[model samples]
Target chain A: METELSKRLGIEHAIFGFTPFPAVAAAISRAGGLGVLGAVRYTAPGDLARDLDWMQEHTGGRPYGLDVVMPAGKVEGVTEADVEAMIPEGHRRFVEELLTKHGVPPLPAGEASGWRITGWMEHVARSQLDVAFDYPIKLLANALGSPPADVVGRAHDRGVLVAALAGSAVHARRHAEAGIDIVVAQGYEAGGHTGEIASMVLTPEVVDAVGPLPVLAAGGIGSGEQIAAGLALGAQGVWLGSVWLTTTEADLHSRALTAKLLAAGSGDTVRSRALTGKPARQLRTEWTDAWDDPDGPGTLPMPLQGLLVAEAVSRIQKHGTEPLLGTPVGQIVGRMNSERSVRQVFDELTRGFERAVDRVQRIAGRSAS
Target chain B: METELSKRLGIEHAIFGFTPFPAVAAAISRAGGLGVLGAVRYTAPGDLARDLDWMQEHTGGRPYGLDVVMPAGKVEGVTEADVEAMIPEGHRRFVEELLTKHGVPPLPAGEASGWRITGWMEHVARSQLDVAFDYPIKLLANALGSPPADVVGRAHDRGVLVAALAGSAVHARRHAEAGIDIVVAQGYEAGGHTGEIASMVLTPEVVDAVGPLPVLAAGGIGSGEQIAAGLALGAQGVWLGSVWLTTTEADLHSRALTAKLLAAGSGDTVRSRALTGKPARQLRTEWTDAWDDPDGPGTLPMPLQGLLVAEAVSRIQKHGTEPLLGTPVGQIVGRMNSERSVRQVFDELTRGFERAVDRVQRIAGRSAS
Candidate 1:
């Protein structure tokens, strides 16, 4: 389970765990892998700073990183209200009708819905970055590939390693040319935004495209055997996201959603644009089906879609609608059958990885003899 | 590369090479891997008998197999003209308009379009099987999963091992229960007929589902490293289809198709129902796009779609229409960048598999030390 990535990142294992919960991030770091706290949920700068403070206190001097969902540009001065106004009335009505059809109750009075779009705004993302550098953070990752050149320079100035997720070799080469310290070769089976290429083809292609740069294989990887396969495909390490959703430390916001995830199989997931206005792999729900229907009004673009669906998503989670409850998850959700502690998952991963390596070695040895 | 599959199948390498060409099949058996020739193209029983005779003379005492594309049922008395008449006039006009729009000329008066339907009828497949048993074929495979129980018993009676392709653990379990000797876990990235699950998730699931039954990992496997990864994922061996399309023994019908495959990348392939009325992965071309267009008359069901498109496909190939010419291929086409002999491909796969195994062993060894 150890490789150049582990040595370079000063971790005991070559595993990078991505989570939005600070508790999970701290637990992952405490368990010997780099724990990346997703910053998209922390729309306010102070909220992110508060989480960083908690991570600093709980990580036991272990390294932790932050992930921001910002596009590559110098975004400035656009407020959430401006983006909110861009959503069309027809789209709003379509969401209301669908939610009504599904019998999802509205939120209680004075309970504001979740705000995920603000963090995607360039200025809010920059503000989050400004707060992140104040902590002992070791990595700054851009969810939508490489951040602006100036942003990379700023992270480098603060001794932070810059990484970006690429779905193909073309994007990986671009990230390398943009001076990214690492490339996360996320494949079609990944939870969030992904391209059409699967990991078996993408990993080797990215590894060859970005020669000498560390590549972490992502998507369709849940167990240690898959991790071993990732390494066999020439990746320096592995990055996992959806497997953590069912961990004891994860705050999935609903018990029903957790139950749904546990009962799902690999075939239960589907790639749809309903989640984030881009093609993202998630559990197939009535919500996704409605959006994908031929007669339904099509989904809007990024920030606009997020703005339109924010309240509907909140209502679904709040009410725990059985057929409508889901989160962004990969096909590996099939293997997340039960709840386990983060440390226990790591133990199984290392053991399984070693077993796979030993098995392959024995086979190869016998072949040669 | 030694596994229980290699030992039981009595092959020198744990590899199954699938091709439609008799020459490629003979060469694969000569190279110590099992070559399963696709039998769906042999509509006439006499044609299949001639090829089986050729295979017997050229296999050089090595084992080979045959794959027939017949559904599990008793099919009789249906002629190709009956299936052809079932196609609607609107669909016929669509195909003709599409070819004319592409400037593809009509075939010379006496040239008949290729016939691929008769073999899919169970009676034709049974006749092909009758001719096949006359040769020393060691394996009999059903391309569309397990054939009828009677067919399975018949193969067993002939001392031939029966194998079938499965796209999910549920399907694998069904195949195992039906007395299939081997299960081929074909994944989403596979060429031609495939399931939605990728190999990384499908292989281990099938292996666990059909305990003690051998599973061969297919899809996204083109190189030795992928083969090593497949074995690591708990498969007894690897099943490869697309990589052979560019091999020297492949009769690709036209130089144009060969050049298209050589220049394509992993992202160039798309899974569309434009072919065979089922979702099959193939190189994206204008022909696929025209069928996939929302404005066009939708594709018909199985044998009908095959009937509707056969003439258009022949015209495209005969004219060497650059934008319209394509074939069934997997994402692994990204790696098949050049034409080489089957022996050369096998040599590279073995070396790559060994190197990957050695590399993982070193990492595990260092971690343990």
Candidate 2:
């Protein structure tokens, strides 16, 4: 399961496990794969520093990475107040009405839990990066697009590799031009923001577009067989996100949402713009349906959309509204039917990859490897 | 590449090349793969009879298949006129206005083209099947759903294997329960009518749902590596549609449409109900865009929608209106950039499959076979 990229990164497998939970990230790193901690949830720099410190201790000197949602250009000067003021009254009224219709109560006073738009601000991301550089991070990945040139240079200066997620060949070429070390070719079936291309088409296209640069296949990849297919499609490894959500090491903070995810089928997920301004694949809930209703107001742009729904989402989680409880998950959620330790999942993936290799070899008229 | 299904079918490779042209179908069979000709375009039973006779002579005794669009229940008593009478006047005017706006003129008198809704009617499908049984067709496949139990029985009685396209595990289970010999796991990125699940997720799910019964992986499979990936995902064979659209053996009739497909990228295709009452993937054109417009009258259900647009589509092709000309295709159109003989394409697929197998074997810590 190892590739040149894995060898360079000092990891044992080609699996890149992405999680917002530092515990899951540390566990993945300790289990012989690169674990990348997502920084979008850490609004305050000190919170990210605390998690990294914890990860540093728990990972047992194993390599781990950090993921930041940095827009291609500078995202400075736009304050949270400015983003809030941009939301229309009609949009606000629609959200309020939607909550009322669903009988969802407001969040308790002084209990803040939903997303903070300021986390997406450039200053906040830079502060998180500053704290990240203080630690021994092996890789830095951008969620939205290629990071700024200066950021890439700074990461390289610290001997850290830069990676970016691309949903199409065009975007992959752009990342290659930006000197990103690895391209995560995330497809439409991926959680969070994704483009129209599926991994079957996008992986080969990206690999062809940037031959020398390694590509990690992502989206709808849960099993070890999918990892083999990714490598078959010329990807150096597989980048998985949703599969980790059900792992014992993950702390989703809501048991109700976890139950819903376990019971969902592949068709249960929908790609909607309700989560952020961009189209993102998530569990289809009454909340997403309401946003898609023809008569209802459409979703607002990013930062603004997140701002408007942050409280409503918190309330939905607080109340455990069965129909509205959901989290961003890929179509692979259909197979994440039970909870398992990160080590267990990792072993199964390796076994599946081996079986797939033997299967393909036999099919090609050769004896099973 | 051989599988149990391919071995039983007496084909050299586990590739199911689906095309609407008899020439392409014959060439695929001669190239050591199963060629399944789409029977929906044959309005006259005699025409299908003639093509089957031609296929018999050209295939050199190699195995081929026939695909019919038969609904689960009987579709008796539905004439083309009856279906036309049910279309709303608003919808008719919308199509007329769209054509006029695009400067697409009406079809020349008596030069009837486009689709015939009657071809989808039960009587027509049965007639086509009756003519098909006279030939040495090795497989009988239904495009929409599992053929009625009697039809499956009839195919089995004739020593023909029956296969049905299923978009989900539930649908695959139904097909298996109906005693269909094979299930084609068609995914969201497939040409023509497709469900929401992409091949990466759908293939494994369908395979898991129905084991011992062979599954053919379809959608976004245009290369040997994808075929290898499909086999890795547990499918016995790969079913392809869009990849053959540009093959030298295919006769698209309209050079404009063929040129459009060759020049298009994977992202250029869209899944819209604008073609039929059901969502079908096709090359996105101004015609599709006009139907998708927010202000336009929404698409009608299947038969009526096909009836309303048939003449307009004929007109668009008749006039060679560049912006309005398109055809059913998959996201794999991105790679169908050149025209080649069916044998050439088959050779490339085999080579690519071998490369993928060797690559996976190497990655799995075994020396390349």
Candidate 3:
């Protein structure tokens, strides 16, 4: 099951997991796939330091990646004061009214929850990157855009491979020109901020745009079949995010886990900007529907939107609001109906991919010996 | 190269071509793939009958399919007068103005160019279906929706297999329930009318939705890597549209053919309602730009939009307006950069698919013949 991409990263397979849980990340790395910890919520220097320390101690010295939310384009220097002013009163009122309607209670007074405000600032991301350098990280990935020259330079200096997720071929070229080590072609079916392009069209285009640069296909990739499809499309490997959300080791709340379980099919998720200012795909919840209404108050830009919805989400998560809570996930959430451990999920992926390869080869009238 | 789909269709390969070019369709059928003639333009019974007669006489009695545009939903009986009246005066004026600004000339009076009006009506589609039944057609496919029960029954009576193109898993289920023999999962990157879903997500979902029915992957599929990806995603075959537009057998105007050649990359196409009043992907042109303009008059719905753009398109084609004249094509138009023959395209697809199968099998640590 070793691929060129896995060999380069010193892993058993090219399956890379992007999870918010360090335990899941460590498990993936330990099982011989590149486990990438979602570092957006870990923007605090102290918080990130402790998390990375835990990952290092738990993963038996295996290599892992960290995904930071460093958007390539954003307004600079807008603080909490500015973000509050930018958000319309109607939008703020709408969030408050909906949370109250959904029976989500207010947080205790004099105790500001860490999840109440957004950590989406580029400065915050830079701080997280600063923390990542202290650890023995093998890969540094940016979800929304190409890393800045300083970040790229510093990572290269530290001998850490840089990867950037792209929704189209043009963006992939930008990553390549920025001296990135890998181009992750993320398609529309992906959970986070995604472009209108799909993986089948985007993967090969990115590969063609940045030849010789390793490409890990993201979006709608959960099983071996999709992995085979990505590889056949010239992608070096597959980077998965949503499939890990429902796994046993995922640190999702009970409400979020329940929502993921009841997803009717792949068609259940909607790509909306409600959760994070950017159009990140997630399960259709009341919170999303209220914000996504075309005639209703529109959303603010990234950090501002994040700031506006953060408290509401924490309330919903804390109260275990039935239909008002959801997690950032991809269209692949439909297939993640049952709960399984990290080891079981990894084994399923590898086994399915092996079976798919064998099936195609047998169809080609070839023998697998 | 033989697949269960091709074996059932009695073809050498599981590749299907959807084109209006009789030469191209006949050639694809002659070369061991299903060649489907686009019958939306053949509203007149006499015209459709003649085309089928010509096809039967030309292809050495080889089997070919007819693709009729029968949308699942439409107005019952709207006459030409009702359609004309429903179109706003400003929208009509915008069409006339855009065509005149592009230097397209009007047709001579009484010449009655065949391309003056759209044949997207249910009545028109029914007439085309009537003609399809009269021929020895092997397959009957509906582009916009599932075939009517009566139409399905009639096709079955004639031993013709029925297929429908779906943009989602839900649509695939409807088609299967309607007694469709096959389902074609068309993705966003496909030319003509498409849905928001991409092939990677849509293909597997549709395959899962319609258990036993054959599924053909379409949209953004022009290469062998894509073909292999389709097969891996569980499609029995691949349906190609835009790739054939650039082939030598395509009877495209000299100007349109040249425009197809200059398409820089896959990013050159846009999915807009300007062409058929539906969100179909096509090469970007001034004609599309004017209709896509938000400040200008908005597009009319369905048959009305088709009625409005029909004459404008004919004038552009006749005048050979390079920048204004464009063809219905997918994002794969970027890869359709060169002028290739039908045989070459088919040969390349098969060879590429075989090599991809071998490559994946080897990566899986399996033996390939």
Candidate 4:
């Protein structure tokens, strides 16, 4: 199950479990795959630092990574008030109408807006990176695009690997040019923000384009057979995200967990811009559908869309309406119909990977003989 | 390059080139891979018979297959006149306006509509199947869904292997249950009509779901490396369509040839329903964009949409305008930037497969030693 990339990263296998839950990350690391904690939701650097501190205590001295969302071309200088003002009145009315239609009750006056990323900006991501460097972080990944050259340099200076998730070979080249240690070629079949290319086509292109730089295939990969496919596509490793969502270690809303487990199919998710002002793959629900209505105002760009929908998401979450509730996920959610421990997932991935390798080797050996 | 599936099929490599071009199909068969001629464009059984006869003459006795598009659930009992009456006046106006804006000349009165697919009906496909069975066809493949049970039975009775292209594991299971000999799991990244899942994830799932039935990976696969990836994902073979488009043997129109070579990229295609009444991946063009416009009437379902757009397509092709010109293709068009003979393309595929296997072997050997 081990790969050259895994040996280099000092892990038992080249499996990366990226999740917002610290417990899941720690559990995955304990299970021998490098677990990466998604730090974008932690608005404050102190919160991320504390979460990492908690994660480190449970990881049994194994290495883990931090994932920050800093899209290379985010709009700057727009204050929250300014961005809020940019959302049209018609969009607000549409959202209110959609909530009524879906039977989602309004939120209380003083309830929190729930977990949302404010680290989409470069400066905010830089603050998170500073906190990450203070810990024993072995890797720092940029989820949306290539990290700035200085960020890559800073991580390299401290012996931490700089990884970037690219939706295309063009983006992968940008990462390699900017001194990224690893390129995660995230295909359209992946959850959240993804490019149009599929992992089967994109992984080898990224590997060839980067020329010796390690490539980690991502998107539509939740099984060991897929991991072997990634390796065959010239990827040195694989970076997985949504597969961790239904694990026992994950912190999920009851409605979301139930929805994912019972209702989600390979075609259940859609690449919609409603959630984050970007085309992110998520569970297709009435909430996403209403936002995409032709008669309603179209979605705003990234930060504005996220900002506009924060309260609506909060209300939806509070009401626990199945039609209004959703989660970011890939088509792989079809295979994630049951809950398993993080360690159990790791075992399956490794065992399945070994079996796939044996199959390939048997074929190769027969040919050679 | 040989796979157990290929050996069973009596081929040198586990490669299947599915193309509408007879020369390309025959050339692929002559070059050691099985060639499957797409018969969706064959408006009549006689047309398919004539084409298959030509292919047989060129194939030098090598086994070849026939591909017919018969999606599982198309509306029946609606005549061409009945469906033509269903198209809205606004959609008709919009198509006319788009063509007029592009300066496309009107078609001469009573020239046959450039595209016709009355054969999408079960009876029509059955007629084509009878014609196919009369020939030396080694296989009969349904491009869109599980073939009718009787169609599968008829193929089996005639000593022809039954195959079906599935976009999902659920579809693949249906094919296996219907007695399909092979399941081609086509990913979203593939050209033409594709399902939402990526091949990296879908191949293994389809292979597992189909049990002993052979699985051929399709979508976003143009190179030998991708072919290796398909096998690694548990597919017994790889099925390709768009890669053959740019080959010298392809029967592409001049504008289409230019569009594919000069403009199509991995990201330049969109899954638009403007063509064939289904979400088919095609080279993104102003024609597709106009049809997807929110202001315009949304596309009608299958045969209706195809019929509605036929005249518009005729004018566009006649005009040869770059913005309106398009072709069904996969994201693999990024790699099909040059014109090679079918033999050259086949050589590259097998050579690349060997290189990828050697790379995998070296890594596996290193770990073992």
Candidate 5:
């Protein structure tokens, strides 16, 4: 039960549960694993503070973490204004037109207007970081890239561990170089922005490459056996995301989308830039299909495309019943049909791990017998 | 332009490919594709001859295929006869001793003799159906699983096409149900026995779940446009086995397993059962650490485990360059340092296909302004 990662996170299990909702985070910590709240969707500082406060109260002093976005490489040399300027009138028109073509209605004028790319994204993300620091978050994670030095230093100052997601070993080294406490070797099979490496190869490679820095295997890992495999391959622990997305407490957008995810097999997802402007795996949907169309305007760079389409995403959640509007998830989402409580999910993983161990033992016994 | 697959077998594109190797039959012709030969390691007399002849002579004079297994897959499933029956007593004692001390190898061996499990493998695989079939071979492919049924049938019936190999999509369906003229949906990154499922989501989804089949799209797909995304996902062409495995009409093995693949990118290869019994993708190496570890046992079923350990495989090819022991391939194999000729490995496929008509039109005449 005492894993290297558990020692690092100062928790009983290295199970770092991520969720955008506070209730789920608190629940996971209550279930004995650390629940990390995602700050990506929090628009206001006060909103994050309130959520963290609630999580702290509910978790009963059990430790937890916080996740923020800090993209390593963005369109360089372009100021926020410049990025906004680069958003072509035609491109904006095209997105609007495409939405219309797809039966999505235009946003009412002046409803959340003047949303500039990069400008608001960085501001909102940093603000959430400030809010996160205000609480007793045990770990601070950057989902997109390495944390800014200030963020890392501030978290360390607050006695919080720092974790960063790395899509490749080179990225892993960058995080190590930046003095990160933990590195998440996320393969393409993971939800959200991920690279094209599988867990089997990436975990050990990252662990070896990082030279002792604790590496948590992410992507396509839902079962206890997969977690055990990660540990077998040198990962200190396994970081799960999609598995949480299908949990009973997850505040998923639609019942239909949830149903689709539950019904899907591991093979049904894809890594496409249509959602986040980076290759993040998710259930293939009509929205992604449009961007994938050979003849359509290719996906624009991050923030810009994301900004242009945020309202559409909001609307899709509001009304879209199609598979295309589902949020990011990993290939493992395929095996995530049944709804289980976060506690039940952990129990199932533990059972699966035991089964894997028993199976391997049996296989070895055959040669002896 | 008239290669064996084209001149003798007569298919629009002489290329043939499929997965689980067993389903090459309908996979090829269904899409007006050719099912190449597969299962060099396991070919029964009737299965091999029927597959080759059926594909070659059946495609209405259209070129079809042939694929021969040349030892690949990892986890050499070899044991001396005495060892096979009772673990040689010596090996058994060693294993038991190790288990008693270490609480069992990290992964135990299966409850069966590795040899016995694969006892019938070689007899069925090395049959060399190509020698018996009188039809001209348009293409040949090999990997895990048995070759497709119709691959031999259609080849002999029409004197036209043939095909083989596949990694995922119910391996059985690609040949049995999809009616693949030729089938293979190798991972985006795989060396052998693949099922890593990248090819941007296992091209063809095993060719639309095996219908109007005639797939090739093997692992990594090694080029821009890759026959224009294998005819934009409904692959009429695209077959690659470790683009890096050295190529020389004479030194195919030597040239294939060099250090070039070792230093390849994250996109390089995946671990899968195509090579060993278990799904595995790794750079080829003398240590062949993948299969040797008692912890993982790493091998899976069929010709893969046999192919990986076969004496003829690179272990003996170049004076035991352990690195060169297993098969090396996939889209990532494009890094293979040296190149060879089947007209330089069918110039149209290796290089020409990038600038082929369909590709040109995809990027043609876009307004730069």
Candidate 6:
């Protein structure tokens, strides 16, 4: 029952579960799929290292992956000082004002909660990468864009697969050209930063563009039938994000956020840069509303925008206020209501895949008869 | 320099456009945001005539409205006799034989040329109401379940505004409690049949369950600022279909049966059974891969399954020889690359609206700050 992707990742199924929670990632790996932990929310390399070590012990040496945000383009690649200087004072002031208005208390001087825009660029990424290398992670994925060649080469030298997220065929080609091992064709329906492309079209295009390279389809994939559809369209495996956000083990917001997500239909999500300074699909909320307001100051760029609002975002989450806390999810969230274990979700998917295969065969058999 | 939609229909902006030719609809409307046709593809009015007529004249009048098939529930209110009786004996034999051979053709009939599955439905729809009643149609819509009562009563009585299409939100709260002015919230993406809900969360939960009902957001809308992200959430106007098919003015394959719509993006389209008997989506091809496949003869009862493979379907469009012709469309079809003219394709929609607004605003000293 090993899937093509599972063979590549040395797992049983091609299912790759993405989560910010180490427990869920471990659950998926224990259940026979690769669970990849998202490292964006962590403030320090030590935090990521601790989580990876925990996953390693829990999964009993099952293969897993590490995901990092490697932005394709940035304002500057110069020294941290140079990049910080590039940040407009107005933008920084705007961030402060936004937090104050939102009633988020500033962090204590020694808290190290917020970093300036471009503050967490290469330096932080490289540190995290170093920590990840120490772990037994079988795969290393760049969540936002292509990993630097050196990073990919280093991972390859360690026998770790290097994967990158691609929103379009053009992006997929870039990953392939960079000698990446895998390309995750994430459609606009996916959570976090994404492009305006659907899975059906993007999957085949990326598969074609990358030629022999394996592609993992992401975004809006919840059921086995969709996974089957992705496979039919040429993806080797499915990369799921939103579905995990609703799982019983997920570290999701309280009842309010869950209710909103359950009640929402596919159209409820919007691709706004308000959260990540990149077009990421998220649950629409008043916070997003404020940023989208024409009169309100527009969103600042990456890291900086995130930095400015990190504390505010945390407070809102801690409070579990629906209007204040926005969750990053995809259109698939509309279909995610009931709480299930990662294993249960996997079983459903497998069942669905079997059904789809049976269905396709029945159709083909009837035609043949 | 007003758009044809604005000038002819006398609307404020040409921001609303719906059509089977999603590309034409998007191009004309997005260029100036004022082009709408009709979702003639799914309406069961006996072929696509009535729907087409409404789209033609309405968009012809002001570049507005798209009529489509939008079934609310799965195959409800249908009988075995109903399905069996609809297909001519000769056609049934042809379909059975075709199914016995290479599986059902990927498309119903219109994939290549001639009338398609909607052909009969279009004919029935044509007789149900007199589109001519709305002499100068501003917009046209359809409900997968049923057209709104007031929409029928008022539009016919006033000779203005055409409405059709509805799915979910309790069928748009009974078309906004029968006051239906223009409520089309179709999901499933695009193409023939739809459902499976994915209009980015069913177009703002059917605009908060049809408040002040002036919505026209269909499945798979294409473009960056389509109605802007604002309009998409609860749009006053945003309707799209498969934006992949050839336009009336573009050259199409005469033999390749399946319309190359399956290759479309999230912005491409969806599939549903409002057209035939089951919910399915695929490129209209010689083999109706999603429907006629024997493994899942599980097509929901429609005008019964007989309507699923009506004789007219096969004759309407053949594969590998004639692909230019297919039936219906969703907003995703905006991807189709070509152009046409509903009064030169509403030149004003693409150019005139902005210029006219600019002139008026300049005169009023209200230019942007």
Q: Considering DockQ, which of the candidate structures 2 and 3 is the better prediction for this target?
A: 2
True-structure RMSD, every candidate: 1.9, 1.2, 2.8, 2.9, 21.0, 20.7
By lDDT, who's the top model here? 2
Query: Please, what are the lDDT tens digits per residue for candidate 1 over residues B106-190?
Result: 8889997764566677888889988898887888988886778988898899889988999889889888988989999998889
The TM-scores of all predictions, comma-separated, are 0.97, 0.98, 0.92, 0.92, 0.60, 0.59
Q: Write down the DockQ of candidate 5.
A: 0.04
Worst-scoring 10-residue span by lDDT in model 1 chain B: B360-369
Encode model 1's per-residue lDDT on A178-241: one tens digit a residue: 9989999998888888999888888889988997999999998999899889989998888999
Greater TM-score among 2 and 4 belongs to 2
| Candidate of highest DockQ | 2
Model 1 misplacement above 4 A: A74-77, A366-369, B74-77, B366-369
Cα lDDT, model 3, residue A116: 40
Docking class of 2: high
- Per-candidate iRMS values, in order, are 0.9, 0.7, 1.5, 2.1, 19.7, 20.8
Name the TM-score of candidate 2.
0.98
Off by over 4 Å in 4: A1-4, A71-78, A89-111, A121-123, A253-259, A364-369, B44-47, B71-79, B88-90, B106-114, B119-124, B362-369
Candidate 3 CAPRI level? medium
Instruction: For all candidates, state DockQ relative to the true structure.
Output: 0.79, 0.85, 0.61, 0.58, 0.04, 0.05
Worst 10 residues of 6 chain A by lDDT: A360-369
Give lDDT: candidate 1, residue A276: 80
* lDDT at B315, model 5: 26
Backbone clashes per model, in order? 0, 1, 2, 1, 125, 112
Q: Regarding DockQ, does 1 or 2 come out ahead?
A: 2
Query: Residue A363: error of model 2 in Å?
Result: 0.6
User: Judged by TM-score, which candidate is best?
Assistant: 2
By TM-score, the candidates rank as: 2, 1, 3, 4, 5, 6
